[model samples]
Target: MELNNKKVKELLPQKEPFRFVDYVDDVDKNNKTIQCNYTFKSDNPIFLGHFPQEPIVPGVLLIEAMAQSAILLMLCIGNEISLDGEKYLLSKVEEVRFNKPLFPNQKANIISKIERSIPHFYFFSSKVYNGFEDKILEGKFIVFKK
Candidate 1:
């Protein structure tokens, strides 16, 4: 199923200026995968200090966007997690590689899939790609339920 901005806002724990996901392009409950899109605006506050002369979306923010996308997918499809009460923490970021630089006003797609799940932690493999299909970043992250 596809989730629009409003549904995404209501489902995701993050608020504006912090929520990175713009739309859920696709979701596969059976495979535990999700494809999401995000656009970095020129006016984003981070660009002010990151490099005003040549503002680019930071690598850290890209990771955050990927993580947010993964969590949103799980929350939307996982029957075990309650939409209102469950809290999740990003416990680990692993093997992150930033291959391309993303600039302001650019759009990227986050493709994420659950790789493993332990007692309290969910592991996800994710990739961020620009419109031209250049890989922006790829990594695995573990999110712990609290």
Candidate 2:
């Protein structure tokens, strides 16, 4: 099903300042993949401490964005499983590489695909691309539903 930003917000647990996903571009259940977008606001509080003169989106937040995207994908496809009270947690992050720094006001596309899955764990390969379509970050991560 196609989900708008409002619907995406409803599905996501993260709130303002922390929720990185701004919109859902696509969700392909057959391929187990999801595409989402987020724009780092220049007024974000983190900029003050991260760097005053040159603010950049932290790599950890980029990873968090990918994890959020992955969770959205799971919620979209796993209709049989009830995720009402349970939360999805990052179990592990592997081979993460930041190719470019994301500055405030820059919009990024986050894409995540399920690489594999076990009982309660889902492994994903994720990437974040800048507006010009240059890959800014790439990584593999595991999410555990608990």
Candidate 3:
């Protein structure tokens, strides 16, 4: 299913300034993969201090974006998970690498796949790519559902 910005807001637990996902392009439940997009607004306050001269999107926020996408994947698939009264927390991040820096106003495509899953923990491999299709970051992370 394609989740637009409105649906993304409804499904995502984060609020403005914190929510990274703007929309979901696709959700392949059978393959356990999801594709989403987020644009780093030039007016974001972080750019002001991250670097006064040459502001760039922090690497940590990129990871958060992937984590958010992972959560969306879990909720969209047939895992029977719901946010009605549940919370999903990022429990771990591993083998993360930043290949390129993203600047303000740049749109990134976040792609994530379920690597494996245990009772209440889900492992995922995620990647973020720039508009040019260049990979900017890649990593593996785990999410704990409560």
Model 1 stretches astray by more than 4 angstroms: 80-82
Q: Against the true structure, what is each candidate's TM-score?
A: 0.95, 0.95, 0.96
- Give per-residue CA lDDT, model 3, range 1-146, as digits (tens): 89989999988899898999999999999999999999998889999998879999999999999999998998998566468788899999999999999988889999999989999999999999999999999999999998
Superposed Cα deviation of residue 75, candidate 1 (Å): 1.4
TM-score of candidate 1 against the unseen true structure: 0.95
**Top lDDT hit:** 3
Error of 1 at 66 (Å): 1.0
Kindly report the root-mean-square deviation of model 1 from the true structure over all alpha carbons: 1.4
Best by TM-score: 3
User: In candidate 3, what residue range of length 10 has the lowest lDDT sum?
Assistant: 77-86
Candidate 1 residue pairs in backbone clash: none
> What lDDT would each prediction earn against the true structure?
0.89, 0.91, 0.93
| Ten contiguous residues with the weakest lDDT in model 1 | 76-85
lDDT of 1 at 93: 97
- Give the C-alpha lDDT of model 2: 0.91
* Clash tally, candidates in order: 0, 0, 0
